[model samples]
Target: MAKVTLTNMCMIYDKENNKVLVQDRIKSWKGISFPGGHVEDGESLIDSTIREVKEETGLTVSNLESCGVIYWFNNETGEKYFVFQYRTEEFSGELLHKTDEGSNFWVDLEELSNLHFAEGMDERLSMFLEKEYSEGFGSWNQHQPGKLQFQ
Candidate 1:
């Protein structure tokens, strides 16, 4: 049987300045991306998103909007990865300088391309930012960047 995994990303957007909260993950995962984590057993996707944002960035977010989803599969290993995308400009908290997951900071949305990110992450972020609704189906390969069909 194939394994299925669920993850989420919560982007805190500042519409006024076109800036967003991003993190540089220096722990188990290494990259500059939004705060998020895997959905726990029996947890709803939305709850997971909120929990992850709080846990990773110390922010309590509300009024979250679902931006999209990503479906990645590795046929050879029969593993599937689903990443739920979310964004919210409504949140309240004193931003923490660092968390176990990484350092959180604000970056201009326009400058995201100039920052380093995990494989395929920049494209994923751009997809969320540019499109109102989007989805992706892809092959997930460990040794290489997988091919994704976007819509």
Candidate 2:
């Protein structure tokens, strides 16, 4: 039998400054990435995204726009992981500088590429920034990295 895990991530855009809020993770999947986490049982995807953002970033996000989904399948473990993506410009509350996850800060869009990003995260940005792609998928075994492609 195969197992499937669901997660959600949000790109909180500051349209006025051309910046996006990011987290420098110190735990699993360490590196600069968006604020997000696993979806709880019985929680809707949108709600999970909203909850995770607040938990991780100290912000209440609204007016969310569904970006798309990114998923990966591990051939060796027979597990599939899905990340439901979202973006929003509307948010409230004081942003936290750090959390149990990592440090949170806003980075200019142009400077994002220069920062150290979590594995596959650099490629994942297309789902939020590009209007054409709706999905990203990858398949791999335990010993190797998966090749991700957007569609």
Q: Give TM-scores for every candidate, taking all chains together and pairing residue i with residue i.
A: 0.91, 0.95
Every candidate's lDDT: 0.86, 0.92
CA lDDT for candidate 1: 0.86
User: Candidate 1: how large is its RMSD?
Assistant: 1.6
lDDT of 1 by residue, 7-59 (tens): 99988998888889999999855889888999999999999999999898888
Q: Positional deviation of 94 in candidate 2, in angstroms?
A: 0.5
Give residue 30's lDDT in candidate 2 (0 to 100): 94
Counted clashes in each candidate structure: 0, 0
lDDT of 2 by residue, 22-110 (tens): 99999989998999999999999999999999999999999899999998999899899999999999999999998899999999999
Query: What is the Cα-based lDDT of residue 35 in candidate 1?
Result: 89
